[model samples]
Target: MRLSMDLELQDIPGQLLLALQPLKDNKANIISVVHHRERKTPRGTIPVRFVVEMDRSKLDAVKSQLVSLGVTVVRAGEVRFIEDVAVVLVGHILDSDLGDTINRIDSTGYAEVMDLALTMPGVNEPSSAYLRIRATGKAEIHKALSILRQVGEEKKLLVIEPIEDEAA
Candidate 1:
């Protein structure tokens, strides 16, 4: 299962190590860690957010480990992203560099291509691609679509966005 865990740590060194070691020992694959060291909580602690892929059953053990290590686990049972958008590209997708297109979304760190289907009828023919993009929220979905629009314009492809998402 995928989880997004929020933790509070002291302003001392090695606090991040404390937050990470439990996930590591519990065999959790750390996906992303957002450590706002410059920002302090009301309790004068640092707020750290972690996204990991781990077994659901081992959640309690990880939490217990963190608590024992003096780390506060604020929230820990959320999936990575909450919003998704589907888009269609109609043009010479392969020749226009598909990998870079996907990377544009993934590199944003706020959105990613969760699914893709491409159809190429002939070597010189235009192809059609269907992509499912997942983002953290509605604003992020718009941000991703903006990037996609720019990419489509640069590649001279037709970008079909959902009508519900076109209310900008």
Candidate 2:
């Protein structure tokens, strides 16, 4: 059976490894992991998404083991997150408290920032960033981008939203 779970882990070194150890102990084979270390949830916790393959009978045991390791399983079931969105933020990103902006978008539970890249030309020049976000569905992805745009506007930054393809 294929299972997807969302978990909350303490923001510390090796915490992710520690959380995964329980699954390994239970003989669960990890298919993929979407780990976001830069953003924290509203509860001040890092969220992790795990895709694992295991027998249905072992599902309960896996949950128990994860809980024993102080990991909070946010959601656990068969559904997978299949949507993704990317946006670019331009103009003085660093000076506007980039961390706070990222945290706000991540706090919305439905979406997470999967990657970020920042560029700065000089001390007085503007900084730009490319952010890749992942969400469970199209609606959630749009909501995340809207939140990010709001943040950028408040900080006097320019946001380049994703353009949809005409023939998709």
Name the candidate that leads on TM-score: 1
Per-prediction TM-score to the true structure, in the order listed: 0.60, 0.53
Give the clash count for model 2: 0
Which pairs, if any, clash in model 1?
none
Off by over 4 Å in 2: 1-79, 166-168
Q: After superposition, how far is residue 105 of candidate 2 from its true place, in Å?
A: 1.2
| lDDT, model 1, position 98 | 98
Give per-residue CA lDDT, model 2, range 1-168, as digits (tens).
767788999887888998888788778888657676656888888988876777768877878888988899988887455788889999988888998888887666556788999999998899889999887666567778888888988999999988976543
164 Cα displacement, candidate 1 (Å) = 19
Evaluate model 2: give its TM-score. Answer: 0.53
lDDT of 1 at 144: 90
lDDT of each: 0.87, 0.81
